[model samples]
Target: MNSRFRRRSLLNSSEDNDPMSVVSNLFDVAMVFAVALMVALVSRYNMTEMFSQEDFTMVKNPGKENMEIITKEGEKISRYTPSGNKDSSSGKGKRVGVAYELENGDIIYVPE
Candidate 1:
């Protein structure tokens, strides 16, 4: 059986080892890689669009006098509630409240 199989293999090498097989496999791998890259790009765009309004900040080793509050929206950013200044005689003034206008033409007041 082994002798017959070897004889057939030697006689018909074209069926077992196609010259285009290597090229076809490489093309398949490239197509898969391109598809994966496309998927990753689309997901990244969706994630950025969905969480566009959401933002955050960090305060490292805040001083004892006061703390700062920061707000961000896209490229525009705003800071609120500045720290206390020792030179000022009145000291740090407390935050009474803040009124924000919504996109749907509504006002919301946030109190500290």
Candidate 2:
């Protein structure tokens, strides 16, 4: 046999019928799949953060005396403070109402 043919035959015989070669190729394919999945997940997370509605909506800032006041309907924002109290306390001092908490995790408050 020619030297070139002999060399090719020798090199090919080492791996041609080896089960380890198939396993190595499978492992390489699995690694590629895992890498692709990670890349996709990262891209999806970035896209969710970019397109989320929280970006468009305004967050309520810390207002007078721990009051969680928000005005949604009015274009021009207005703040109204009930006379005498300034610490913005809740409970019976919270609103113009008597609040009752029910057994089903619901709150019912009636204005005074």
Candidate 3:
């Protein structure tokens, strides 16, 4: 038999049926899917950080006795002490406000 014909017959024979090819193909497909999922997750996380603005104009800067927390959605939550007293009153001393910049180049403080 010719070499080409012999090779073709060998490939067509049942003994040449290798199960490793199926396993290797499945492994390749799974690897591709895993890489795609990881990339998607990383992209989504990066997009969230990109969309959130961290900088905000100081509507009121907190002093040593006060605490100010700014949210990613531009909401400012402030906690401060009463005028001269050292102790804090939850109902009377705590103040909440929203910080926004006005069109006239001024920062507007809106009490919430």
Candidate 4:
């Protein structure tokens, strides 16, 4: 009598058909998916940090050259002079007041 005949697998007819191989293959697939997910998360995080503009400053005034007004939020608003004073619809006079509108619809004007 052979030992192979005496020993039998509960689910398979022969030792060659061991179910552990299937379990190992599943584990390998799961590991690969886990690694892929981790890499994707890291890449997404890096991309978000690269292109995000939340930390950048904004320019408030585009046409002005000599004067720059930096807001509380770090935005730089600029005002410039035309070498010769030309009268236009836009006031050429000095800034008389600076005002900010609040969320409650109230305007707060800074004393000049």
Candidate 5:
């Protein structure tokens, strides 16, 4: 009778240990890691406004030839790239401001 009870207990323990449980646990861990990575990246690049409902603008690689201007307004997003022209104007608008880059790479805008 003791041997029969031990055999039944072993079978019960084996049944409780499902192989699929391990896979599910691994999937949960992966999802948590992915979320953490996304949060870190967003904060690192100051991109938290991207998830907000208000309008926002972002400049990537500012002052460089490959610079990109991203603007989000009222559920619409627009991307503007420099046309490789030394003068950044459409030849129709009057100049309203001037921007100067400081030695520390900070840009200052002075309205004319």
Candidate 6:
């Protein structure tokens, strides 16, 4: 047999099938799956704005006692929560509109 053929056969031999190579392939597939899952979750919840450089404001658990307001402006982020006092009103702003939450969690605003 030729030397080049011998070397090619040696490289293609069953004995060269290392178990570690299988593990490496599995690890690569797992990394791809993890990245895909992260992208799906970000798009599912409309959370792409959280990763952008533009200003955005998001409300979590709206109309609940544990509601949270997250605002991002420039490179700064701020979170606001209620003080748990239901009887206090401090702002001088007038009520220009009324908002009603429907059964499907959609809000409708009606101007005064």
| TM-scores of the models, in the order given | 0.34, 0.33, 0.34, 0.29, 0.65, 0.58
Model 1, position 30, has a per-residue lDDT of 100
Error in Å for residue 110 of model 6: 18
Q: Native-vs-model 5 lDDT?
A: 0.91
lDDT of each residue in 1-112, candidate 4, tens digit only: 4666556444456666787988998999999999999879879755333234344333334566543432232343333334434556357568878999999999999978
Q: For residues 35-75, write the lDDT of model 5, one tens digit per residue.
A: 99999999998888888999988899998989999999988
Worst 10 residues of 1 by lDDT: 57-66
RMSD after CA superposition, every candidate: 10.9, 12.6, 11.7, 14.1, 5.1, 6.8
Candidate 5 residues lying further than 4 Å off, grouped into runs, are: 1-4, 7-17, 85-112
Residue pairs in clash, model 2: none
The local distance difference test score of each candidate is 0.72, 0.63, 0.64, 0.61, 0.91, 0.92
Cα-lDDT of candidate 3: 0.64
As a whole number from 0 to 100, the lDDT of residue 13 in candidate 5 is: 97
Error (Å) of candidate 3 at residue 14 is 9.5
Better of 1 and 5 by lDDT: 5
Candidate 4: misplaced stretches above 4 Å? 1-16, 47-112
Clash counts per candidate, in order, are 0, 0, 0, 3, 0, 0
| List of clashing residue pairs for candidate 3 | none
- Model 6: weakest 10-residue lDDT segment is 86-95
Q: Who wins the TM-score comparison?
A: 5
